[model samples]
Target: MKHIRMILINGPKRVGKTTNANLVADMIGRSLPDGCRAHRINMADRLKTLTNSIYNVRTPDGQIAPPDYLEAIKDQPLEIFGGASFRQALIYVSEVVIKPRHGKTVFGKWFLDTVNQVCKPGDVVITADTGFASEIVPIINQVGGDNALLVRIHGMDASFDGDSRSYVHWKHVLTFKDDTNAPFRIGDASVRPDVLARGGFREIDVTNELGFPERSAQAVLDYAARANWLVRPTEVDLELAKGPTL
Candidate 1:
């Protein structure tokens, strides 16, 4: 164990997750030595080229399956395609067969590999995080789970702060329609707080008390202190907090 703290930022789109992530990273970095600082990696950019590469794929029976068709057939009975014929197809469909096909590619092992290679213990690694915990947490444990923290930034929902909106009483998810015929995804309120509560992780509600930028930064530092990370905000951290230039 290298004694590193990795802050995995989780939240829905348009919910100020990246902004808060940068602030937390800067605050953590400021607590470290002058030359060292927290490292924030936006995973989408790192995996772009690999995700874009085109691969010509043929199933076991020499039948070529396009990306869509490969995914469409994953859970169907093998009897339809013939057991032996589909078996080979299954092996070749990397995109379709990986991690039960979430909204996009799960990026599971490969993403974790990149994170492991780039970050070590004692360093602050904050990622625009995705991929389910099942695929990522085990690898993190290989280093040290004690040093890791998963921060789930729930979208700002002021209603939840009011007594009228208890967790059980309220359930509203925002959905988005794709203009270009892309997949229709829930946008406004898809992230569930209960699921994030698992794994004993800390929760920061951007909905109330810390919805604004400055408050969000303070909330993070406060949480770190409460958790015993012992962050003493320095001049550099103050400067970093002024704006997200870095």
Candidate 2:
């Protein structure tokens, strides 16, 4: 049977998850056999599309506005679209509208379907936007425990500090209030805590104090190797296998 390696990189926003994921993907691509490839997919791809549509903005080529454009206009008033700032509007649509109607795992299911349809055998698929347990659990179930790895990046400026009012929670759409001790809940369940409690997948906690430099990438690669997701030939083994120079 053909096997696909799926790596889900989970962490607070702006903490170099995407950088690390790309690094891991490049490493895996270099190590893969001929005809195999590595791909990086974002879980928020569809959400971003929906948000663009809500904003009713399009590129000159008629495509939806890209993320950079969206980021630039995130603070624009949505009075015509009937909301607050574009950023808050996206949060409202995602948390209060779509998720409540379609279920929390809707995006995860869509992502899994995309992977099954587009990914080939021996492909290494990585996503750096994982946040909720509702999303990760279903994807892990589809990929199987042995084939999936959940990497949690830590030590960044926005790292979660167990405070409901922390910037990490705010980035994830959690509301901030005077009582910072309250649990960070997105609906009924606590956000980060729920994700941490999920099992059935191999996990590596990467301390990315220096962002995704050579050292941090190597740290992630080492953890992946220990998790059995990567099998790299040692230098001594390669040297011994080499025949004497003719």
Candidate 3:
């Protein structure tokens, strides 16, 4: 089997996760071989489509019906469901039932089974999103171990970025209150942490290369300059023709 490689870009919100992911994708694309190509897959988009509005759902007749909607999912048994007592049982149900299902699309059985629907071997898939790394990383290690590259982007400077990169602004309902008792909150929220204790990967500080004095120093440029080492050579015989190593 071809050694499949997946570059997982992970970081907290407002940390330029998406922008930096695109930059990495561009660098990889520019340097890739003919048959080898790089593509960026935003798991956030796929996730929203997979999980229908599980929280704050409304009845067709216009009645608030979050709990009624969660009634169906409450049956699925998730042990982690009991740890944190959420203000809204409905939201909790969605957490345990809906979000965990993303693993099927992320890096395991369902991912391999349906990968051809979007990707193939020799394809470098750069993915970005927020979920439980502890749970997701294990599955990735189990299935794609050597083929996966987990990238943790850290130390954000959103001020100079001149834009709102946080998903809280876009995906969140802003004024969401699951019920009268539930606190008004942002989104069906989560954070992507930098520590992946088990996965062997790269940690890039997206901000370290940016800003006034260091304008020319960029993470993408640095990676692009050295990426050739990471890419498999398209031809070995041609290289062997030159010389042999000691």
TM-score top scorer: 2
Error of 1 at 133 (Å): 2.3
lDDT for each residue of candidate 3 in 1-246, tens digit (9 for 90 to 100): 224566656555445555556555655665566777777765444223233243334567875543224333434543334532222333343355543543212322233433445666666767665333432333343333345545555553433132212222211211222331224322222212322233344333345233321211134335434544245332223222222211
Could you tell me how far off, in angstroms, the CA of residue 124 lies in candidate 2 after the best superposition? 1.1
TM-score-sorted candidate list, best first: 2, 1, 3
lDDT of 2 at 203: 68
Question: At residue 17, what lDDT does model 2 achieve?
Answer: 69
Residues 1-246, candidate 1: write the lDDT tens digits.
Answer: 336566656555444666777777767777765545588865443333322232334556665543334433433445444552332343334334332343222343345556667766556667654423433333343334445555555645422221111221011111211122224321211223333333333444443134365566567667666766654653344554648531
Residue 179 local lDDT, model 1: 27
Please, what are the lDDT tens digits per residue for candidate 2 over residues 81-151? Answer: 57566666666777776776666656777787778887898888988777766665455445565677767
Which sections of candidate 2 miss by over 4 Å?
71-86, 160-200, 231-246
Q: Give the Å error, residue 214, model 2.
A: 3.1
RMSD of 1: 14.1
Clashes in predicted model 2: 0
Worst 10 residues of 1 by lDDT: 168-177
